[model samples]
Target: MLKILKYLKKSSISVVAIVLLLMVQALCDISLPDYTSKIVNIGIQQGGIENAVPEVIKEDDLKKLMIFIDANKQSQVKDYYHLIKYKDTESDSYKKNIDKYPALKNENLYVLKDIDKDELKDLNELLSKSEMALLTIENNKNQDNKIKESILKSFPIELSVKMKDKSLIEIMEYLPKEKTNAIKKEIMKKIEKMPDSIIEQSAIIYVNKEYKSIGIDMDRLQNKSILKSGTQMIAIAILSMFVTIIVTFLAAKVAAKLGKTLRTDVYEKVMSFSNEEMKKYSTASLITRSTNDIQQIQVMMVMILRFIFYAPMMAVMGIFKVVNTNVSMTWIIGVAVLFIVFLLSILFTFVMPKFKLVQKLVDRLNLVSREIITGIMPIRAFSNQEYEEKRFEEANRNLTKVNIFVNRIMSFMMPSMILVMNLIGILIVYKGTYSIDSGTMQVGDMMAFIQYTMQIIMSFLVIAMMSVMIPRASVSASRICEIIETNPTIKDSLDIKTFNPDKKGVVEFKNVSFKYPDAEEEVLSDISFIANPGETTAFIGSTGSGKSTLVNLIPRFFDATKGQILVDGTDIRDVKQFELREKIGYVPQKGILFTGTIASNLRYGNRNATDDEIKEAADIAQASEFINSKPEGVEFKIAQGGTNVSGGQKQRLSIARAIAKNPEIYIFDDSFSALDLKTDAALRKELKRKTSESTVLIVAQRISTILHAEQIIVLDEGKIIGKGTHEELLKTCEIYKQIALSQLSKEELGNE
Candidate 1:
């Protein structure tokens, strides 16, 4: 994972922005719970108001309260004094004013009590006759009053008089305990029996005057709070969504660019590889590494960007909220998160090693599939289709089984997470309900706790999900790194020098020996030869006699293991491979072509070739005849590997491609093997004239192919048994005589 991070260094600024945005998004999410708590605790239960003044009080009680209210400079103290100052003859006017200031009811009660006993009797008789109506008032405060100012005010003024006259211990003695107790009981009973209608009228009057005086509406304040919080939540949600979309797009772009860079790097590395390096990783495996393996890394990169940073930040912020909630239930979240972590750790431990095997299996599947497609004709001819099918099915089944196992294990994750989340919710509700009953926590607070707990759990859940992908992506990253890190065994030296000789196209092998990697014996041994400029040198041998290997060394496809190969009389190793190859045109045993028009393939080695040069090279290689037969001619599209063309046609086009380069040295490694006798003779005849001033090295199996060469070398079992012209070799060399007699009549050899 850390190795992969190096590639992301260029995207650091964007990454930091994504993280900051994610943190902002998390903070917004956390704040929602607080708003929800407010709506529940203050909005629904408390009716959106916090403080209310009393609507009714007794005259003596009001006077006592005024003492404290005066000290505090409370505006309501004037209302209290009004209630006490107006009584008796003004009681009816006060009753009329009670609707506006019902707090004066205490003064009316004092007036009723101080009335002449006979007059009080008459008033009681008038109330019993139901002639008077009850005054009504209402209080709108949401909060219950903690300080009972009404009760404090209702205490007897005589208690204060007694306390001022004597010490606290002597107060009861001076006042007479029996009289004080009787008066308190009687007054409390009368206050408790106050009519609901009268109290409601008083409360309404008190609230209206207070609100009018303060110049504020209680309902508006509550509405604004709810609206403000709701608006903030919506704005944050939209911002979070916007950030998510932008981050997703940026992450995808970064992953794609990373994949592109990696693929180009791998391709450049493979292009520079020699035969030994190519052998280290097969063609099919290299294809998988550059494509499927890199795709895995790309996918992992997206997940890392989208979730890896976001999850941890969310989790940290969630933990912060939980700690600040000031509750013991926070430990419940910790335990739940730890359990999730343990579950994921166990699953990843079992699955990570298998991810490496999965890529290898894919490589094998590709190898089998490619071979089956390329060798379909041969498989049918040999009646081996069933064997191939069984082979492919077995590999497919192995890959499928592993994928199923991994998928099955991962399927348990979502369900387990849900279960853990629900269990935590149940536990919180159990504890929260008790707290609510005890008045320690509110419904809104409990709801907020549940949401925060889920947030904390989900953070770990995101990490758990990523655990599955990281392992697979890590395996793919390692595979891609392998190709990039591989140092090609063959490379030009830092002090590479240019090769210049008096005569060009002179290729010489000086006591050269060669062996394939891990082979027990050399394929070619102690070979010494020179093909001078303006000459054609041909090699003929039984299969595996190093005919192709010997020529392959000239272009530095592989360097000589035991000796030196010289091009233009300078050691080829001293020159850069690209510079050395530019001087030679090589046609392989298998004629390969890319997906393009014939003209494009021909121009591959020399892009500056003119149309005339393309036609001239095609005519010399005898490919012009077939090419002109097609309506598109040289513009005809060739399928990859030239699969659309016949073997002989492909060979002709390969020869034409080489000829287009017009190199000083030309090598034909069994290039004529696919051609018939007539076409082969025509091509060689034309090539001989065209390359008269250049060196030509030909590897052939047929004696007719090399009959007129300036020199013919006969090889057997990695060693040269004969070297001379055909006529001289027939007379002196037995190996040459055997090969020549097999393909020609004795009279034919004599004629030559």
Candidate 2:
């Protein structure tokens, strides 16, 4: 996977943008739970009161609260609230506040002035503790003697007994200033020990009663708080969704563009391979690398862009939110994460090895399938269909077995993760119930903690899924890289040399020896020959006599190993492969055609060829008979590989394609084996007349194919044993004489 990183440089800008958008999405997702906490804690439970600091209080209630407040803090608290007397109700300021606080018509009110968040927070803390102390003393005044004893212990015993039946405010009026201050100090000490949340809850109850007294609508306040938070949640969700869509779109585009580029480069690389390189990689493997392997990487790229980057961001942010929400339940998330990591580690150990095998199995399956399809006729002719079926089934079953095993292992992931999540949720709620009952945590905070914990676990799940995909995609990336990175065994020299224009149509091999890349011995050894313009040079030998290999070297299909093969006095290797092949027309042993019309296949030789030139070439190769007989003539559609046509017709068309090229040299590599004696003789006669100015090289098994050639070379094993025209070879070369006698009668030889 890392090997393909350079290819991703073109998409760097989009990738960076995706990263930024993923951060935004993570932030939005992390924020939603906080709003839920606010709605539950403040909106529903506190009657929409966010803090313990009352916005408005009756003047008498404010004085009652001030009794418990510290002397230093009382002045600051009083400074934040202004008195509005009933007499002032007629003024503009009082009139403006009257509708909000309708009880202003009967009593003087103390309304809070504008304050910053820091000051408001300080005031809330100060007032929350004071209000809790007042509420505690008042509620305890009516309780049993034991509870009242704890509160009355601050006063004298006789004084406390008389004050037991009085209200807390009345008791305070009976005590001296020093005694009252001492009692208030003791009450504040007890309230300070209580949790901040409990203190705030108690204070909010008192504030709610004050709001009721001031004619403030509590229902409207609660509804507005809920609605505002809900709207913000919805907006953030939509924005996160929008960012997610853009990220997915950009990821897919980058992956698809990379896939296209890889396919094209793989194809061009394969096309440039010499025969040696072709033998290094099988056709089926190359197909899998270009198509299936590349597809795997493309899919993985999208996952990488979406999950790889986003999952970590979410995980980190979620952890931060979890820590900030409540530290008590964080252990549940920690245990859950450790268990998941262990599960993923075990899975990785077992599954990583199989990913490599799966790609190889796919190659095997494709190879068997392609061989069976291409050789179906031969298999049917030999009555071996059952054997081939068994071969195909073996490959298919192996692939299926590996895939099922891998899938079965992967299928365990989601349910196991869900089980962990469920168990973790149970543990958090069980643990959180105590905190809530003890007044250390609220319902809203616990709920938010659960969500944040889940988000953290979900991030790990995304990473686990990608971990499984990465190994397979990594294998695929390596396979694809093999094709793109390979250097062909045959390449043009860095200091390229052009052909000698004055010596056109001349091919020479001086002590040229050749061997396959993997072979031990040379297929052609110490071979020397020259075929000049306006002459035909032909090679004939028994099977495996280096006939085809000898002719193949002239086109530089495989460079000569021991000696030089030159064209027009210029070494073939020194010139570019394209320029070398352009001057020679080559016809392989098998007649191959693409899926197109006859005109198109013929035009492939020379795209600029005119209709008259095409007709003349077809007529010379004896292909015009079958071509003109068709309803569409030259426009007749040719099936792939020309399978619709007979062997003889395909061969004739192949020859016609080469002839249409009108090159300096023509190579017929046993290309006429399917033609009959009559057509062969006629085609040869026409070829001799038309190609009289071009050198021709032919490889043949039958002696009649090369009988009329100007020069004939007979190869035995890897050596040339004879060279001459037909009559001279029969008189001088025993192998040539024996080959001729076996194919033709003495009377025919004499007549020739």
Candidate 3:
């Protein structure tokens, strides 16, 4: 919540607007009970009602007031000022919904007359100009406006032909037409025989007619007790509503604001870690912490702001009213509340531990679901679909069972509170009736006390509900905090001198070594090499030979744990990461892409890259063939991860992304694994020709792939046991010779 407060401070303007809206709504809600009390006790009881509203109020003014109250009951309805004032609600496209159904106007169903004339005119005009009717007709027939109008109008016509849901068919079936008038006349006589006072009271309460309008003497004004009580209810209702609104709005925002702040902090902290530290925690865990944990905190904050807050206020106010209203029956309300609290506490203590367990299980279930979706193809091929399905089902069932149990326990509070409250009510009424008969209490005073007693219990019930969620939210908050506090092991050193881009792309590793965090063995050991400008250096080894790891060091994606790497004769440790990576272009083995146009992905490497430059890069990477084949050409859309494209195509596109940047150094980490031999050779030939001025580093498994390299380093495990050209390596290096022998005979090797 504290973190959320920080965010609220930044977005304080929205918070304030929301608070103001809620307050208005709360005030309106509060006023309703008061209005009810006023009409019942003040106007109806007296022979002459005294209270008056604005003179401009119409005969049905009470109904209008009620309607307004109902509308104001919704907090969102009260938020209209925010939307209207700022124009930041739904966009114009969504708001102008009437534009899509022009024929709705043609039937005279959607009338032009409205309370707001400007609104009516604007609505009518919007309906007329929009081609919505024609647009929705399956794209073909919809364009034929005449057919569209006929189709749309026929439905309402079919319904209007008969009495629909408003049918009075049953009464028409049972009653004879001639007898209906006779029956109604007799009913009217019975209604007329009702007491005159009842008639006057019902009229003032339900019909909004004043005493003068009804021509009745208003003696109801003298019963000031009911009138005062009712008026106080209205005022209190209004006050409660306003305060609740302000509190709730601020509360909801606190959750959202906290989530955003906490998430941002977690991201910033994770980013701060050096590459070495990043590898320690899984990406999935970090994502869960930021999204799920923060979300939990957010949800809790909203509940706390809205419901939890109301409980205590109600308890306090209810107690005051209940006790002060009827001093003798005070113990009843207090004892009932105490019982509720004790029951709630016992329930919470038991449920709190379960809620924590439930959250952990939720996290696990989410993790498994994500994994299954991501590896759906593998699961199918391996025939583990049933296994995964059963696994998920079991997890789901357990989660459901636990939640149901928790809810079962939680659901107890409300009903129990209401029942206990009712029992207390019975006793109060029994005792109050005696007081009233003995001339010690008034009927209205006893009624007010009962109302306050109910409120006190209700407040506790609200607290009970909030308590169930609090434990879970607290756990989530702690999880989020842990993530936010984690410092990255690899980060930019403060005060480090950044790399200068003007220097040639010369890279060298001096006795470089690396070990995975907390691992037993080194992945790269005592490796020393250099690649100068205008040269192609390659590393070749079987899988797990640290080929990719070696290239990863160049961009500082993973720093060497034990040695120094220099770029342009300056140690990379002295350079800022942004300056170091800007000069390097890398294409990884797996081609990762986003949901966007090809143009967008291409421009990600260099935001300012021109269309011509993109095309050239595409041509250089052997991707132009497929890209031009697309209907939109470079504008062709790529689904997330390039799932829509073929493996070979995705790889080429990834290469093109790198080429578009035209950086000083190019690192291809087995980037051509998906390409066909013909395209691979062509791509390599093009790269060699076009990128002669830039340093090139390639990691490969195929010997033929790196045969043309100026320097070939043969690695086994982490150690660079051999280094030379293809000919030199074949003659001197044993591992290289064995690898070369596996591919060719002695004569073929000699001939090469």
Candidate 4:
């Protein structure tokens, strides 16, 4: 995890920003439980109804609130009865003061609808009844006072205190308090001081205010607790989600980048090695390292981004929370966790070695699959479908058998974890009963703790799940690293100078010797030879005679261990490998081709090769015939590895690729083995004419193949048995004489 983090730190700003986002998200998530505690203790416990809200809803502005609707109609009727009598007296006074003519303000006039005095009195009686019910509910002294204030604010003070217009909420806020008694006395005095006629004839305005969250009454113990807990959990969940996404994305990006970088490094290292060195590791193993191993590492990185911090934090915090409960049940859970770890650890320990064997088996299976596909033509020609199938089945069966066993072992982990959890759950329930009886635990507290315990156990289970992949991926990483760290036996010169490839070709071997790594004897011993401008020097020998190995050195595919190889009088090593290789055109024994058009293959040697140059090269290599047969000509698409083309066509195309380079020296290591005699003869004729100014080296099995060469070298077991013209070799060297007699007619050998 640390290593992955360090890699991500290479892009510090982005990583840090994402990490911050994750932290913020986690903060939100953690806030949930804490908020739950608040809701339970404060909102529900206190019965803050005005602020109370449902669990699913979110409103914070709500405070103590109530809505009182109706007023006391009975009190209004009694007041109306008195007001009629007072109004008669007021009317008499008005008549007496008519001469004074005092004007009435609109505020003092009646705002109520006109009604018969008897009907107005009846409505007042209903209003008084409604007010009594409201006041009756809030009969507490404190409540009455608040109700009195609610009415004063909701209505005109004249309407509320005088009982002219009333509100149920105002009555609801009414508390039976000492202050209520004093306020009521003062209100009665003010009402009496006003004429009763004014209260009976006039109406007043009042307002009712409502709060949605507060309306639900979260102040109740159960409701408030649930609301607050839910809010906190929601906040926590949001934070967790935010943190998870940020971390997972960042970790995945970093892991992918590292994988790509590691891939590049591995490729460079492997590419630096010669053919012999490349043969040391199988292709499947290399692929697994690049893809499978990298993916495993990538997954680990993703998890670390999301849960690395969370896993440990949850484990530790859960432990603390659980332990603080101080219930006797702690030991049971601890033992269960320990047993689970031990069981899983043991299971993994036994399976790890078998998993490695599975990887090897998979490599073998891939090798077989590759061979069957590559050698499809041979397999079909030999009618070996069943034979190859059996081989493939054998290899595949070995892999499947081991993989099944691995799956079987792995399959046990989750169930075993669950089983352990269940057993521990039983113990917890049993122990929880005792704690409850002893007052060491509450029902809700035990419920929450049990939930937390499950979370802790699951986290460990997840860790165990991830641990299973570690050993296999570790092996793969080591394998990949090993390749990347290896120093190639062939290395580029540190101090290289520019060189030209246009000079007259004169390649010389000065007692060159080379031994493959881990081999007891040198493959080529004391090989000293020269091929000058406008000449062909061909090597002919039996199998294992170092023919191809000898030509390989001239190109520096592998450096000679004991001697110097020079080109144009300068040591080839000092000339720079690219320049040295650019001067020599080589065609290996097996023609290699990638999936592409004919024109693309021809351009492999020189990207800048023109159409005319490609045509000319194709003509010289005898590839023009097959290429012209296709309707698309140079645009003809080839299958992967040249599978679509005939063996001879593939060889011709390979030759054309080298020919397109038009290098100073051309090396053909039995590149013509697949061609027919007529095509071979035509190709040689074309090559000889086209390469009149270039040196050519050929490694062949047939004497007829190199019969017309200016010089021939024969090898027997890595030593030069003879070096002369073809005729001279048939007479001078016994090994060459045997090879000549085996491949040539008497007439051909007689001239030799």
Candidate 5:
């Protein structure tokens, strides 16, 4: 998978954009839980009173709070509050305050002034502690002896007894300033030791009472806070969703573009491969690499773009939020993550090996299916349809069994993850209930912790899913890279040579020995031959005598193993393959045609060939009769491989395509075997006239097909046993005479 990412260089800008968008998406996702916590903790549980520092407090209430506040901090707190008198209705600020806080109409109120977040936070901390201390002392006045003892431990013995009778504020009023300051300092120390959450809750309770006294609508305040937080949550959600859509679109585009680029590179690489390379990789395997294997990489690319970066960011951010929300519950997330890793580790052990096998099985199934489809006629003729069915079934069943096994293992992952997630949720809530009851954790904070835990777990889940896909895609990437990285066995020389204009239409093979790759013995050895312009050179041999192999050398499908083959006075290896093949028109042992109109197939040899040229070539190949029979004529559609046409007609069309090329050399490699004698005779006779100025090479099985050739080479094994015209070879070459005798009578040979 990493190997394939180099193709994404073209899409680097889009990938960067996707990364940025994924970060935004992660931020939004991680923030939502924090908002939910605020809504629950502040908006509902605290009646929308966010902190210990009240926005507006009655002047008398403010004085009560000041009694508990330290002298040094009291001046700073008073500086942030403005005294609004009920009689100051003429003032614009008093008018606004009276309308907002109606309690201003009854008494003077102290409204908090604007301050920076740091200052506000300091004020909130100080006031929250002071409010809690004051409330504790007042509550202790009527409590039982045990409760009073715990509350009064920090106070002096005389003050502790006085705290049980006189209210805290009255006792503070009577005491000297030095003594009262000392008592306040002691109470502050005790309050400082208390949990910050408990202090904030206690402060908000006092703030709620202050608001009620000031004629503030408590329900409206709570509703407004909830609505504002809910709106922000919805907006973040929509924004995250929008970012997700764009990320998905960009990721898909990058993956699809990469797929297209890979397919093209693989196809072009395969096209450049020599026959030796073709033999190294089977046709079915190449097909899979081009399509299914590439598809696997494409899917993995999207996942990598979507989750590879995003998952880790989410996991880290979620962990940070979890830690900040409450540290105690973080253990639940750690254990859940460990278990998830263990689960995935077990899955990988069982499933990774199978992924590689699945791709091979797909190749096997495709190979079997292609063979059965292409050979259906042969199978039916041999009455072996059932045997072929079993072969296909075996391939299919093997593939299916592996797929099911892999799927079963993967199927176990999601439910198990969900189970772990649910169990973790239960444990968090169960553990959180104790913290909440103990006044250490708030409801909102616990809820947010649960959400963050789930988010963190889900991030691991995404990584786990990608872990499975990455191994499979890595296998696919290796296969694709094999094709893309392979250097063709046959390549043009760096110092390329061009053909000599004076030596056009000349082909020479000097001591040419050929063998298939990895073969021990040469198929053709020490062969030497030359075919000049305006001449016909024919090869006749038994089935394995290297006749077709000899002609195939002219086009350089496979380079000669032990000798040099040259065309137009230049070594074929020194010239580009395209330039080498362009001068020759070759029709293989079997006729092959692509899916297109008949005219298009004919023009395939020379795309610039005119309609008249097409018809003329067809006429020369003796195919005009059948072509004119169809209503579409030259426009008649040809199925792939010309399967829609008869064998003879397909061969004639193949011959016509070669004729349409009108090249300097023509190779007819048993291309006439499918035709009847009459058509073959007529085509050869016309071909002689049409190619009178060009060189022609023929590999034939029938003696009648090459009896009139200018030169005939007869091969007994890989060696050329006879070379001469028919009449000359019949007299001098015993092997030629016997082959001629087998195909024709003595009178026929004498006549030729």
Candidate 6:
């Protein structure tokens, strides 16, 4: 997975944008809870607008507020100046004040909150200190509550409190009676400037008038808060949606590009592989690696972009919000997250090995399927359809059984996650209810806690989901890497030279030998031969005599294990494979053809071949008669592998494709085996004249095919048994004589 992540560097800007958007979205989500708590705690719990302020503000408290207003020149308080002057609180002044300054009433109401916070704590302390000073001045003799009240009300509350206990007692005793009375009279004069109370029938009457004059409009406040919060939440949701779309699009684009690049890389690498490498990884496994394995990595790339980045962020932010709201309940999120991790760990450990095995099984299944599709006719002809079906079913069932086991384990993931979430929700509510009753939490706060907990759980759920796929994707990445990292055993040699010899179409093998990779013995050994320009060289031998293997070395399909093969005097290994193969037109024994028109298959050899050149080549290979007989002629369509055509026709077209290239050398590896004896004889007659200027090498089982060749090399067990024309071989070579006698009578040998 990490290997694939390197591809994401191209989209770094999108990644950063997605991250920023996620953060904004998360913060907005966290903000809604505070609004919920506020609406519940302030709007509904506190009664409507009428009861938003305290009823009984002391008379002295009002005067002190007025004095502070005067000193500060506060413009916000200027509208309430009438209250300072409205001493007759019992008259129409209360009603008139509400009618004159309705806006000021709401301001004054909420300002009480600030006033209560700023002045209330110190007010109680001031009252307590004043009582102590009064008692000390009276020498602990003031049992009369009224007299105590008079002394307390005589001076400024702050000033009286400031006088030390020793000073107050000394003032009462050391001062003369007249001086003491004069001091008391002066203090009383200062107190009289702001009257103790207005002309109300009682203190309760005074308190009622004040509350009616100034208090909050709670309905207005709640509506405004709800509107603001709702708008914010909607905006956040829209932004989050846009971010998700962008992230998804970018992730898909990256995955597709990664898959395309990986496929291209694998294909180009495979194209460079020698037969040794091709054998190392079978055709079916390579197909799986290129297609199925790449798909796995592509899917994982999307999940990494969309979930891997998002889950951790959400989990961390959710945990932060949870701890911020109620630290005690944080353990609930932790326990849930831990449980999810444990569950995922158990499943991943068991299923990951299976995921790797599944790919191999898929390869096996593909190999069987391909074999059945390619060889269906043979299976039917041999009456082994049921056997083939059973073989395929066995492979299919093995893959199916493993898939079911893995899926059965994975199916529990979603339900188990939901179960954990529900159980945690119940646990949170159970604990939160007690906290709410104790006044430490509120209903809205509990609801927000639940949301945060869900977010945390969802984060872990994302991780759990990813855990299931990451192992599989990781296995796929490694498989793809295995193909990509493989170095072809056969590659172009350094200091490569061009092969533009004067004697074109010359091929030579000097002491050549080859062994299959990991084989105990060589398939071909110490073979030496040369096919000169404008001459035919053919090999005839029994089965497993390295007939096809020796010819394969000419094109470097598999490099010679010992010694060297040369084309036009240049070592084939030292020339680039593409350059070397370009001069040689090879037709495999099976006569493979791609899906296209006859022209397209022929053009595969030379895209620039003219109509006349195509017709001439087909004529030389005895393919023009059948090709012209068709309704479309040269434009006739051919099915893949030429399955729609007869075996003889397919082989003729294959020869014609090679002939159209007009290459310097032609290799026919049993290419004429499919044709009838007459068609074969006629085709060879035309081929000899057409390729008279090229080096022609043929591997054939029939004595008739190579009897006319200028040089026929007979091989047996990787060693050359004979090297001469047919008549000379029949006279000198035992193995060649045996092969000739089996295919032709003594009279036919005499005619040759």
Listed in order, each prediction's TM-score against the native is: 0.80, 0.94, 0.71, 0.72, 0.96, 0.81
For model 6, name the residue pairs that clash: none
* Model 1: per-residue Cα lDDT over 1-752, one tens digit each: 66777887777787788777767767777778887776765555433432223223354433333322223343423422333344544656555655544444333322222345565444333222111111110121211121122322344776554344342223323444565455334433443465433333333334344444433454675676567667776887787788788888888888888888889989999998998988889999999999999999888888888889888887888788777664667889978988898889888887777788889999999999999999999999999999999999998999998888877778887888899999999999998888676555668778988888898899889988887888788888888888888898788978887777684788888999999888889999999988987889999988888899889888888888898888887898898888888998889999999999999999988999999999999999899988999999999999978888999889888999999999999999999999999999999999999899999999999998999999898889889889989888988899889888889899987886
| 3 versus 4: better TM-score goes to | 4
Write the number of the candidate with greater TM-score, choosing between 1 and 2. 2
- For residues 37-97, could you state the per-residue lDDT of candidate 5 as single tens digits? 9899989999988889899988887788888776688899999998888998899889787
Instruction: Please state the error at residue 115 of candidate 2 in Å.
Output: 3.6
The model with the greater TM-score, 2 or 6, is: 2
Q: Of 4 and 5, which scores higher on TM-score? A: 5
Per-residue lDDT for 268 in model 6? 93
RMSD (CA, Å), candidate 6 to true, equals 9.4
Give lDDT for model 2. Answer: 0.90
lDDT-superior candidate, 2 or 6 = 2
Q: Which ten residues in a row have the lowest lDDT in candidate 5?
A: 142-151
- Model 5 regions lying over 4 Å from their true place: 143-167
Model 4 local distance difference test score: 0.68
Q: Relative to the true structure, how large is the alpha-carbon lDDT of every model?
A: 0.75, 0.90, 0.67, 0.68, 0.90, 0.76
RMSD to the hidden true structure, all candidates: 11.3, 2.7, 25.0, 14.5, 3.0, 9.4
Worst 10 residues of 4 by lDDT: 57-66
lDDT of 1 at 704: 89
Model 6 spans with C-alpha error above 4 angstroms: 10-217
